[model samples]
Target: MADFIPVNEPLLDGNEKKYLNECIDTGWISSEGPFVKKFEAEFAQTVGRKHAITVCNGSVALDAAVVALNIQAGDEVILPTFTIISCGAAIVRAGGIPIVVDCDPVTWNMDVNQIEAKITPKTKAIMVVHIYGLPVDMKPVLEIAKKHGLKIIEDAAEMHGQTYRGQPCGGFGDISTFSFYPNKHVTTGEGGMIVTDDDSLAEKCRSLRNLCFQPQRRFIHEELGWNFRFTNLQAAVGLAQLERLPEFVQRKRKMGAIYTELLSDIPQLELPLVKTDYADNIYWVYGMVLKDEVPFDAAEAMERLRKKSIGTRPFFWGMHEQPVFHKMGLLKDVSCPVSERLSRRGFYIPSGLALTEEQMQQVAMAVKELFN
Candidate 1:
């Protein structure tokens, strides 16, 4: 038996140790440290945004974005049912209703065409979450937002170093967010950032992440906010990772290409769409959907792969199908067939930055043998 290949392993062989050592030597390990500011600034510049605010994690970044946009109760925020719970949770936590639409079957991203139909007078924002390896068609979403006067909250958490129509992924919306989870191209262990061109919105996010602290007075708060602060130690890791993003992206793309070549002959699988009119795939993860004729779902396939020491991860379950959403009396009676099918059928292979050619070949062989 081969070594158990985990679903994701981060590549951290850059300046991470050097920067972390500097932090320890200087005693600047908290959120007030200098590395946090440096990471925020560099990340904002890279994404072509005017302001970037660091938060403890990606979920709170969405939370801050929702509050910063002032999405109040009874206000509806349009989003895809195919995304992670964070997108809808942010709105629900802000007392706003989440109005979800289905994703495009091919792109596996929020269907831009369906977004307009879902819009209503109560709609306040459109949360566009770029799916596993591709972007939601932003041009149509942008037009829809402009037509309806709705805010656009771009979630580029899975799309670090990726672009849409030549523009950076995180630069497309009124406010954008990114995660620095270990699985991402840029890993900070655990961190997230919000970027925006609007100074007021930027300021709101900064205040929101730090318990809405007043500049003039300590321990004083004008509005209630969470302690979602990213520490300097995390920022040190993030800054180092950010510097190597271009290299990481290149490696990911190469890995994806190799996997596509290796698995393209398998008729029972639907491989990821490699390109679109707007942009080429950065291949954050090499995902596949089991065709209807496979006679088995992703769960079964993943189990079989696990027995062979090959790890896998299921695709995100749709928000409409979430039991918690039903418990909260949200998204009740909502049906998105595409998202439902994807949730059951899709799974991603190991395409992490640290994945090597030999491991990739082993994974491909295991998958092929299982199908045979």
Candidate 2:
């Protein structure tokens, strides 16, 4: 079998093992310890957030964000239809209705134009996902949210170190969430964090992250919360990864540019479109849309890539069509045309940190030949 290139891979050459050793030697291997604090501080600084609250995973970070924002039952939180389900799920978990809509065809993110139409009286927040490391067009989203009394929760899970209009991806929303999953730009084995500028929200987030401990006394509980804490071991690894985040982002951007250059003339595939102003895409997943007139289906193309040992996969089907959402009776007359079309036809291929120049070239060549 040929060597299989992956979509994403953790680069562990830096201080991962060294920090792991330090964590092990210190015996603060559980959720508590200094490493977590250090990681949170560094991460907040990276994103220009006033505070950072570490958590177990990206999902938990979102959940915490909603709760900190005081989202109540029946309240609506707007989201994109084409994205990882976790973005919407966090709202439901926090007792809010997830009002999802279509994203832009160009950016494959929230359609800022469509947002105003969906705003109802009950709308409380908006969860804008920075899909595939491309920040959502936030200038209008923020303006609309401000006109109404809606808060923005940025899902920056796939976009570490990505910038938009000179601001970091996570810095746009009132509160943003990040993932340190192994395959992310930065890895922590498994971890997440919430970034925010609101001191009250941050304080609420800090308390909520650790099971609502009373400041007056450690044992005394105030309100119910989760033990969604990031372990010292994980934080140690994250710190190491953070130190090299800039390099990772640069390499990803370079790889994306190379892919575009090589595949520019390929009529079978449609490359991603990043609007000039917010196009500082970190290229987390390297998504590619299939040409409307492609002879073969995107799924078939994915199979071809896999057969060549160059792994690829199709994009998310719109959430309303998902089995889970269907079960919730969300398969009604809602039409998010862009998301609906892209979901079935768009796909991404391997673009991990470990991909060498030769590997990237080979994959691009294979794609061209497969289509020809």
Candidate 3:
């Protein structure tokens, strides 16, 4: 039997062990340690932000960002239909409605052309999620935001080292967020960050992550805040990962090139987009959308690959199609055909930093065998 190629595995052969061991030896394993501050500072500098607030996870980072911006009821946040439910949930939890929009069929990102059509008096923000590895056409998104006086929330979770028009991905938004899950370019086991240049927003996120208590007196609270604090242990791992980010990004791009080279000619598959005028695809995970002429959708295709000991993951099911939201009578009339089709047909192969050339060959061979 062939060894199973898992979809993701982190490359932790760097200073991870050294930093973790240091944390253990010093007994500074919690949130109150130097590594947390160091990680925050270093990451802020990397992303070209004045402040980067560490959080327990990416979901909380979005939640905190929405709250920090004071997005209230009657405000609408325009976001892609093809995104994790966390994006919509954050807006909803902040008492704002999420206005779903279709993605560009080719890029699989929120369509900038559709953005203006969705705008209304109630629209307050546009949430641009850099899907897979490609940055959204931010030049136009920024233009639209400016024209309508709308805030831009950039979810750079999947785009750690990616840039838009030479500027880092996280630098474009009023507030941006990142995840350090093992699958991400940067891994802390589990951690997240929110970055912004706005000083007041930065302090509010800091206070919100720790539970809105006045710093002078720990027990006293003026506002409700969740315990979304990041531990020093996680930060230590993140710092080690951050130190080697450029190398990781190069590895990701190389993996993308290998996959595209091997599988580009397969007739039944549509590979991840490669380049745009703004930026090149970083290929965070090598996703492919099965062409309609193919006999199987992503679920069926994934099962076939699994039988051959190849692991894969399906694309995000759009928020508008989510049962929870549908049951709540939200987005009842929303129909994003492109997003729905992508959700059903698209999935990613093994594109982890730890993935080897041989493993990618096996994966490409497996996919070709199935398609052929």
lDDT (CA) per prediction: 0.93, 0.85, 0.93
Model 3: per-residue Cα lDDT over 1-372, one tens digit each = 899999999999999899999999999999998999999999999999999999999988999999988899879999999999989999998889999999999999998899999999999999999999999999989999999999999999999999998999999989999999889999898889999999999999999998897968989888999999999999999999999999999999989999999998898888987899889999999999989988778999999999999999999999999999988778988899999999999999988899999999999999999966
lDDT of 1 by residue, 187-214 (tens): 8998999999999999999898888889
Model 2 CA deviation exceeding 4 Å by range: 217-220
Ranking by TM-score: 1, 3, 2
> Model 3, poorest ten-residue lDDT window?
326-335
How well does each candidate superpose onto the true structure, as a TM-score? 0.99, 0.96, 0.99
Error of 2 at 4 (Å): 1.5
lDDT per residue for candidate 2 within 106-204, as digits (tens), equals 888878788898899999988889887678888999899989978999999998988888888899888999998877988887889999999999989
Give the candidate order by descending lDDT: 3, 1, 2
Tell me the lDDT of model 3 at 63: 97
